[model samples]
Target: MSPAVDVQHIAKAFGQFQAVREATFEVRFGEIFALLGPNGAGKSTTIRMILDIIRPDSGTIRVFGRPLDDAAKNQIGYLPEERGLYKSQKVLDMMTYLGTLKGLKPAESRKRAMSYLERLELADFAKKKVSDLSKGMQQKVQFAVTVMHEPRLLIIDEPFSGLDPVNRMVVKEWLYELRQKGSAIVMSTHQMNQVEEMADRLLMISRGQQRLYGEVQAIREQYAIHAIIVEGQGDWSRLDGVTQVESLNEQRRGAVRLHLRPEVSYDDVLAAIARDDSLTIERFERAVPSLDDIFIQVAEEDAQEVRWLNRREAEREVEKEAV
Candidate 1:
């Protein structure tokens, strides 16, 4: 089957500055795909172009085997970076109106709107004006509107920006539920932890270029540290390539975080440590790079590339002016 969304060789610019450069990726059906990058990395521009909010200067976007069209648009839902609501409008009325715009009728919209409100614990605030709700409450209301139409593809940008931890969890759970129901989600966020927890796959972009895109677990494995943490009794201090060994707690128990030598095997480490029969083993597990580390490494590498490009551009400018 075709991907739920696909962007190939997409590029966009504003006047003289390119916002996105040859960005490309695909979002599989029924999976949560995350776009992670720092600010000004062309995330918003790429998203806008994909949604047809802004036409790409060059490239193609396909949704479900067809180009972006009214049918595709109707099948997708979007929650933007900036939240907006009619301050004077009742929560239910506002959401119902937005839902209606998606082709839902008054009765159907109200039914789904109330169901979402109840599920989000916002049922009590149905009659209240948007302005009366707290920031988090308002966010939930906006979320309700985003899903009221039951779109197959959901694109949410910074969905957790203003949410408190409690509400954040609420939203997170709802997103997972949507994925289980076969919704294709393309979300952009700075919260690496959330991406790690929720995203099945991710695309990392910098300066509108794709830096990394793959299954989350596979990417983590690609950058995996071939190391292990041993929590047991052994004089690991003398172990070779063991970069750091710190005490866990009492003298009888300690943990060693090892950075193995290229030729050494984990089995060798365990065998050496097990020599001391008196030493008790507590925990032994391989160390893997966290999502934060991967994100930082990718972003830092991209920043370095951008700096190099800027320097090259500067040199070209000076050479031209010299002539």
Candidate 2:
């Protein structure tokens, strides 16, 4: 089957500010595709273009192998970063109304709305006004409404906003279930840990430019440092081929991170540790950088490049004035 969303070289700008620059990617069925970027990095603009909320300045977007139209729009469900609901309306009533707007009959919409409320542990709040619910509860109600119609493609921004850990897991499980049922999910969030746990593939944008795009694990491996994390009692700094050793705990008694020389393989380091009788080895493995680490690294790199470009431009203007 064709991907649920295919965006090719799409660019959008507001006045003189370019919000998205030649962004391109695909969201396939039965998978969670993460849209990652820092604030004002054009993620919202790109999503708007895909939803046809705003027309792109250039490039093409195909929803399910065809240009996005009324039918295509119906197949997409969007949960924006900002919540929108009738605050004065009761929870169940508002949800049911939203469901009908998505094409379900009144009875079916009400049934599904009630079922979702119960599943999300908000059944008791059915009669409560939307404004009376807590922020997290309101968030759940919005999510329930978004998926009640079971759109083929779901675009959710910060889906776990205001949610505690327990509720967060509930939403995560729901997304997994949707993916298993062949719904293409596009999640945009700043939570790197959640992204690492849930996303199959990701597209990261920096300064409105596509910085990284690939399978989550592949991208992590690409940014992996040549280091090992050892959890045991040992003088890791004494090990041969270990360039540096840093404590991974506050007490300095739990795990130590060993930075290895490029030429030394993991096996070689393991052998060295084994040879030292004083060292007690409990857990040893390669130290993989987390998504948070990668995100900061990429953002810092981009910022540094921008500063350099600004400096070059300033120098050019100075030279022109002198001439």
Candidate 3:
């Protein structure tokens, strides 16, 4: 079967400012696809184009193997970053109304609304006005409304905003359940940790450009450095082929990151450490960078390039004025 969302070289611009230069990716069923980028990096614009809220300047977007149409719209559920709910309305009533808007019958909408509220631990606040609930509670209610109709494609922006750790886990489990039920979820958030936990594949944009796009684990491995993290009682710095040893903790009794020479194989280092009777190895693994590390590295690189481009443009303008 075709992927749930297929965007092919879609580009969009507002006047001379290019919001999305070229974004191409596929979100498959039963997978959470993460859209990542720094602020003003065109993630929102790309999402708008995909949802047909804004048309792309070039290329195309297909939802479930066909061009997005009214029918396709019905199959999509969008939870924008901006929260919009009737503050004066009771939580259950508001959720029910939103569900009906998604094509659920009033009775079914009410039923599902209550069911979701219960699942989200907000059933006690069902009769309370939306404004009466805490921000986190309101966020949960909004989430309940978003999924009450159970669309095939769910697009959520900053889904964990205002949520505490406990509530965050609740929402995470809900998304996983939706994925298991064959819903394709596209999550756009700045929470790198959450994305690392939930997303299967990801597309990262930088200054309207597609910078990285691939399976999450594969991408992490692709950016892996030649190092090892060892936690044990040993003088790691004495190991041959180890260029540097950095302690991971303040007390110096915790794990140490051993930077290896390029020519030295990990196996050789492991063997050498094993031969040293003075060392007691408790844990040993490759030093893989986390998603947060990768995100910051890419963002910093993009910012440097942008600064260089701006300077070059300034020089050209000065030359023209001089002429």
Q: Estimate each model's TM-score.
A: 0.89, 0.95, 0.92
lDDT of candidate 1 over 1-323, digit per residue (tens): 89999899999999988888877889988899999887888999988888889999898998887888887887888999998899999999988898888989999998899889999888999999999999889988888888888788999999899999889889888888889999899999998888888999999887777888999989998988778877866567677567666544535546666778777788887787677565567888776777888988988887788799999999999999999
Cα lDDT of model 3 by residue, 1-323, tens digit: 99999999988889999999988899999999999999999989988988999999999999999999887877898999998789999988888888887888999999999988888888899999999999988888888877888989999998999889999999899999999999999999999998898999999998899999999999999999999989889788889999999888635477888999999999999999889999988888998888888999999998899899999999999999999
The best-first sequence of candidates by lDDT reads 2, 3, 1
Q: Count of backbone clashes for each model?
A: 0, 0, 0
Q: Write the per-residue lDDT of candidate 2 for residues 1-323, one digit (tens) a residue.
A: 89999999998889999999878899999999999999999999889889999999999999999999888877789999998789999998998888888889999999999999999988999999999999888888988888899999999998898899999889999999999999999999999998999999999998889999989999999998999989888677888898998887536467888999999999999998888999988898889888998999999999999999999999999999999
Q: Ten consecutive residues with minimal summed lDDT in candidate 3?
A: 246-255
lDDT value, residue 60 of candidate 2 = 97
Candidate 3's C-alpha runs over 4 A off are 246-254, 314-323
TM-score of 1: 0.89
Question: Which is superior by lDDT, 1 or 3?
Answer: 3
The list of candidate 2 runs beyond 4 A from truth reads 246-254
